[model samples]
Target: MFIDGRGHITLANRMCDDIFQADTSEWLEHLYYDCIHDHNFVLFIQYVFLTETHAHEQLYFDDGWSVKHYEAYGTPVTNSKSQLHGVVVVLHDITGVKRLEEIRKDFVANVSHELKTPVTSLKGFAETLLNESMENQDVQRQFLEIIWKESDRLQDLVGDLLELSRIETHNFQLNLQPIDLSKIGAETERLLRKKADDKSLQFNVSSEGNKEMIGDAARIKQILLNLLTNAIAYTGEGGEVELNIYEEAEFIVCRVSDTGIGIEKQDLPRVFERFYRVDKARSRDLGGTGLGLAIVKHLLEAHEGTIEAKSKPNVGTMFTICFPKEWSGW
Candidate 1:
C-alpha cells in the first residue's frame, strides 16, 4: 500500500489486496489509523515518527487468519529541490522466521538452565570436600559422599541432555531395525524395577494385542526411562505407575499413567517446555533437572510421533504418545 507521511493509504497493489483478503478501491485513501485499531500499534506508528527510525513488529489481523510480521522503514523522500517529500514504508513478512527464532532461543535457554543446576551443585560440594579435608574425618567423609552423589547426578543430567539434543537436532544417525514393542517395554521395566522398588511404587507395563513396532531400541528405551523417571518423581510412595502400549487405527500408542501429584490445569500446557516445572521446589528436591519431559516431547517428535498430556489435581497425569504406522517399516 502507498501512503503519505501523514499516515494515509493512497494506493494498494493487487498483491496487497490478496494478502489481506480485502476488497480493492474500498480500502484506498483510508487513514492508516482506521485500519489499525490496536492501541499498541497506533503507539508504535507514533513512536516511528517521534523517533524517526525504522521499526519492525508483528500484528495479528482482525480475522485471525493471519499474523503480519513486518519491518517498516520510514525514509524521507526528496524532490528535485532536495526538499523532504514523504516517508515510504515497506513491509516484509517474517512470521515463520520469527517463530523459529523464538523456538531456538527457548531451546538454548532451557538447555543452559538444566546443565547449570547439577554442575553448580557438584562444583560446590566438591570444593567443600577440598576446603575441609582434615577438619573432621567424619564430616569430610560426608562431604565427599555428597560430592560423589552430586557428580553422578551431574553425569546423568549431562548424558540425557546430550541425547535429547542429538535426537531433537537429528545429529545422531539412527540404526533403524524392526523390534517388538512388548519386549522393549519389558526391558525398560526390568531396568527401572530396582529404582521403583526403592521408592515403594508399583510399576506395571502391559501391551495390548502383543503388538510390534519398528524403531531404535536404545532410543525407545531412553524415552521410556525418561517418562518413567518423571512419573516416579512426581508420584508419592505407594502410588501406581502403569505403562500401556497398544495399536491404534494407523499408529502405535503408548501411554504412561501415574497416581502422582497431578499437574494444575495451567501447568499442564507448560510441562513439555524445557526447564518448566509445576512444583519447582519439589522438582529440585527430587533431583529433577526439568528437561525430562521436554526431551520426551522432542524425541517422540523426531520419530514422527505426537505426545499429549492429561491431568487433574490430586488425581493423576497421563502422557500418551502416538507414532504413525508408516514408521513400523522404517
Candidate 2:
C-alpha cells in the first residue's frame, strides 16, 4: 500500500485489500489503521513511514475459509535528497511451507516418544537380568525375552520411520511392475498364519483370476503383511481372518477382513497418523510401533493405489485395497 507523508494506506493490490473488502478506490482513501486492526502490523506500518526503515515480517490472517500465512516486506519511498515519503509493502504467501514445517515437527516428536518407550523397557529388563535376575534361570529367561522383544520393537520402529521418510520425500518413486495379488496374499498368510494359529484364530486366503496389478511388489506385500499381522494381533481366539484377491472393474483388489476388536468411528479418520493408537497400552503390548498404517498410506500413494477401511466397534475391520491392472505412471 502507498501512503503520503502521513502513515495512511494510499493504495493496495487485490491481495493487500484485506480489511476493507471494498473497491480499490474506497480502500486507497482509507488510513492503514482503519483497515488493519492487528497491533503489530499497524505499528510496523507507522514505524516504516516515520523512520523510512525497511522491514520484513511474517504474519497470519483469516480469510473466510481458513487461516493463511504471509511474508511482508516494507521498503521506504524517498526523494532524491533521501527524505522519507512513505513505505511500499510487498506480501508473499507461505502457507504451504509453514504447514510442512508443522508436520515435520510433529513427526519428530512422535518418533521420539515411540522410541523412548521401548528403549526404556529394554534398559530396565537388561539391568534386571544383569543383577538380581541372573541367579534365577526362569526370571533371567523371561527378562531376556522381554529385552529381545523390546529390541525388536525398537528395530521395527526405526525401520518404519526410515521407510516412511523415503516414501514421503519428493525424490521417491515406486518401482512399478506387474505383480500378482494372489501370490502376495498367499505369502503374507504363510508368514503370519503361525501367529494366527497360536491364538487359535482361523486364517484363510482365497484368490481367483491371478489378480494382476502394476506396483512395487515389496511395498504391496509389506502393506498386506502389516494388515494381516494387525488382524492376528487384535482378533481373539476362535475369530477368523480372511485375505481375498479379486478384480474390481479394471483394478486388481486385495481385501483383508478380520473378526477382531475393531476401531471406533471417531478414530477412523486419524488411524493412519504416525504413532496414533486406538489402545496405546494394548498396542505397545502387542509390539506395534504405530507407524504401520502411515507407511501403508505413503507406499500406496507412491504406487497410485487406494485403500478403504470400514469398521464397527466390537464387530470387525475390513481393509480394501485397489491398484490399477497396468499403470503407466501417468
Q: How far is candidate 1 from the true structure (C-alpha RMSD, Å)?
A: 5.0
lDDT by residue for model 1 (1-330), tens: 555667776776776665566674676667767874556556666666556555666654444765656554444455788554444555566667877988899878877776677678778877777676477788778877877777777787787777767775745566668778788889999988988898899998999874666677787778888898888888899999999999988988889999998999999999887778888878878877777888888767667789888998778899998878777434
| TM-scores for the candidates | 0.73, 0.91
Q: Write the per-residue lDDT of candidate 2 for residues 146-210, one digit (tens) a residue.
A: 88888888888889888888887898877777777788888888899789889999898999786
Residue 49 Cα positional deviation in candidate 2, in Å, after optimal superposition: 2.8
Instruction: Judge candidate 2 against the unseen true structure and give its global Cα lDDT, from 0 to 1.
Output: 0.83
RMSD to the true structure for each prediction, in A, is: 5.0, 2.2
Ten residues in sequence with the least summed lDDT for candidate 2? 16-25
Q: Give the residue spans of candidate 2 off by over 4 A.
A: 18-25, 62-66, 130-134, 326-330
Task: Let me know the TM-score candidate 1 reaches against the reference structure.
Answer: 0.73
Superposed model 1: Cα runs more than 4 Å off: 1-69, 74-87, 95-103, 170-173, 247-251
lDDT of 1 at 190: 93
Candidate 2, residue 285: Cα displacement in angstroms equals 1.5
